[model samples]
Target: MKKLLFLVFALGSSCFLFAQDETVQALKKDAERTIQKDPNDTTSKTWKTGGFVGINAAQGSLSNWAAGGDKFSLAVNGNLSLYAFHKKNKHTWDNTLDINLGYINTTSLGSRKNDDRIDLLSKYGYAIGPKWNVGALFNFRSQLFKGYAYDDDGNRTFNSNFFSPAYVLLSPGVEWKPNNEFSAFISPATVRWTIVKNDSLAAVGAYGVDPGKHSRTEFGAFASLNYMKEINKMFSYKSRMDLYSNYLKNPKNIDVYWTNMINMKLTKFLTLTYSLDLIYDDDVKLFGENNDSPATQIKSMLGLGFLVKF
Candidate 1:
């Protein structure tokens, strides 16, 4: 059944790419028509605003994380992003700035809890005379839900109180488009900062005592490269490689992690996304006691969701 599900997702992704091509083509044609109709109309402007909202529904199992479930469970996840921007001229070199905001919410592994996250991002870029474009990005993330806990002696305890964690990142990037259908992006020195962390369980002795309690800060850097190629007139191939590291304050510890995500559009409104998450960290105390060795873990998830543009 899982194999069959994967096959379906693959097919849907292929079809979605075809639809993207058609949409882009249609937009291009419209722009050309508008330009040709008024050769001397320098006062007219060309700008576009659009985004997508999606609803995702699926059934799967999660593992590796404490408080997570190993048994089959029904899950739902969704997100929405909207933006509007304008460029002075299509041929003239002009900078474009967009304020993009989005939110995502998903059910926990046991389906008894929920995780909600919100993102506020800004992207600014300018064409450095043609094939090269440079940009900077700022992103903020907030985890807006409570977590589960157990009694001091290991008995399960539940509550309704919740806290949120905040993370911020700054990235300066460059995009090179050798031609019309192919492009690549690299962000060499992106920095991420975590301003808040959860530690209630540790204070209560459910998780071992730690030097840092309540909220703490951590600093990290990441580098990633992404390439996309247009296949035929309707499909495109996308791939990315990333490396990240973090060093936490007191109770000194470090961690490194990587993530890979592949998404295929099934249509103008639907997309299939598959992700692999991996982490490797040095000895540390989790829930209060000392974890003896460096741990490496991998997690995977696949989901289908709708994408809408307005």
Candidate 2:
């Protein structure tokens, strides 16, 4: 449903962009002609729309090593992003709606599992000065496939064993681009409140009330910093960092996570990427006892990918 919503928006935007009148066409032609006279004298005068797609093959390790086989798993991921932008007079505005869908299936002969996830994102921003802008970020995620379980007696007791997890988040923040190559978003910290949650493990049998059964709100501050250096015209080096923290009120717990990614553009259509994710979770006391110790988990991935823009 979330994917379909974005597809509808993309189709509508395409139709709107191609349905421009003669007046709009004349203005665009004049603007193009004027810019052709002076290569350096470019001003905001029109609107444009575009999209991009990317695919990658990656390998990573799953924490806790479920299924008791191999800790490493192969992952294939893909993303689709669409944007519409307008430039008028001295101000420019850009709106991007993106959808990400990916699946990772792992197998070690007898032990196997599949994890599929989807994300829908929307961003809207307007330029205040040359490199200063403010934007809003909205995102949603849903888990499609979850595994099943059986009793110690080797009999199927529960027919539905897996739960679908989903989240809806809205973040309002400001972005500053000091130069054409460096940009960052900071302020109000984007707080992603969890509106929908379903976890089968938390709802089965006696341990059913463990914070994951129903809707619960998690508070977090979000920040993103990106730096890019252009190497020639089609290649560049990019680095991005994202931080999030969730404070659970009832459980009296705190969860902090950070993801850092570095990518080298091998060509106009390909990239080599490396990502590291670190998570720190505080001790959780359940029934007057903590299940596990307060520890840190690290996960990393390396992959080569292709990018396409339209």
Candidate 3:
């Protein structure tokens, strides 16, 4: 249902965008006007929309090279981030969607998914003060393709897939938004759903769901912080942190997720991006010598690609 909602909203946004015949020159003029306006004025722009799309690819062929490497290798990665924000008459609505997908093919390892992610966030707030608001926040995250890990015997164990495991979180809370670039939201009443729809996975109780159930619900206290800073036209940074503590279960065992991204525009069309993500869930156990123990998860990526902005 969360995924359905996201797709519906995404489709509506796309139709709305195409319905307007906005030109590149007009957008440039609008950008010029935006630059001239008071940067700190939150109400200066009633509707704001933009996004970045990038693609990176690499290929290598080795012919008896001295350095040991795969005979043939290729990698391709693509990412998109879109945001739409509206602020008027003490009411604000913000929505964002981010997707990343990658694949690698090598003579030794075969083709596999190196990265995959789908994330959506939406929030609506009614102001109570200059920097405080009553709001409801919703977020959904999952992946796109099947994931597996290979062992010495060349047997692959299924780990994840599209919607095989997903997370949906919703909270009605107070938000402290000091400026357009920063916000913190917290609430004691929060509901989170951990979903594992695949029958094979649910049979084994993957992702903390019951052995025969497709989903698990948790009532918890949740807090999140989001911030973005642009040092200059060429450099920018964004980060988000989320924390949750289940009141019905181990209340002291908290779940933490933090992610950061840095972007650099080297030229009109050239760009570089770096992303880091860290996650720790008390209910998730690692697949290792001690499968019962949980461990921190970390992922990082760096890319040089051609970028298009709108």
Candidate 4:
């Protein structure tokens, strides 16, 4: 009877120890799953970098054909966009660059530029909540080459050159980013500087600068919205809008800058793209057939091109 009792006690102790070991292993696995990071979390990425480049071209040649058109013509457009972002913990940094240039040549019109742009932006943020951040942003916008306004008589007037009307802004703001596809920044105090470094442009007070002055400064309320989304496997769209109200000048006449891009992917390297831009500034004047006034400017482009991604 004593030996049987000893055996029973040993078996019971072994069974209890085995069951406790299984429970511990299950708990460990559960903890690991809870703490493991998700691969698709955009906010937690350490670094992300990518860009796209595209070129579109068109040409036409006519001999003795009856069609009434330029004997020879060619048009080419090129664009580049780049971005880099870093995010970790509660801090984030983003930078972007964009450029576009286009030219058209024809027997009747010679060579002229159809599009020109350069834009750069950088932002830094510290997250205060799940969807809110305290942020500071810097932006610069200008053209790459000289721009001209041609009249009906084929006479051209020099309008702009590099740095002739560069726009720079620094904003301390609050940002809301609830998802990967949308972000908005709002600032009560934004500093804007318009620079016209060219002597000719400065003499005429181009782009709202004081006469004979190379730059103008403004304090304003500013807001910006950025949204990007992939509609499906073959279609995507992105847009940006900026609004500014100058407190030192005419606050009621707001300045606006808006851009939109739509892309349709045909293959891995081929795409059809459309881009639109709209700008309006109260201090800038546009010469029209009737009078010179502050008017909204619009530009749009559509083309099929080969795209390269990096």
What TM-score quantifies how close candidate 2 is to the native fold?
0.52
Tens digits of lDDT, candidate 4, 1-310: 9999999999999999999999999999888885666888756449999988998788999999796889999988899989899898999998889999999999988899999999998989999999999989999999999999888777888889898899999999999999988999999999999999999989978889999999999999999999989899899888999999999988999999998988898999898989999999987775666435789999999988888878
Q: Candidate 2: minimum summed lDDT over ten consecutive residues — where?
A: 283-292
Clashes of each: 7, 0, 0, 0
lDDT tens digits, residue span 1-310, model 1? 9999999999999999999999999999988884345766668655556555656676556667688654456666555545454555323222222121223233432333333445555545667857777876566655446544454554544422333245566778776657644444456566765443445543542222243554433445544444445454334344444444543332234353444545577887687766565655442223334333345656566678875546
Give the top-scoring candidate (TM-score). 4
Candidate 3 global lDDT? 0.89
**How far is 289's C-alpha from truth in model 2 (Å)?**
13
lDDT of 2: 0.55
1 against 2, candidate with superior lDDT = 2
Per-residue lDDT of model 2, residues 82-167, tens digit only = 76766675455555454444556555422222223354545556777777777776666554454333344434322121223345
Tens digit of per-residue lDDT, candidate 3, span 142-254: 99889886776667788778887899999999999998799999999999999987889889888888899999999999999999888899998889999999998999999
Compared with the true structure, all predictions reach lDDT values of: 0.51, 0.55, 0.89, 0.91
Alpha-carbon TM-score of each model against the true structure: 0.50, 0.52, 0.83, 0.84
Error of 3 at 77 (Å): 1.3
Model 3 worst lDDT window (10 residues): 34-43
TM value for model 4: 0.84
| TM-score for candidate 1 | 0.50
State the number of backbone clashes in model 4. Answer: 0
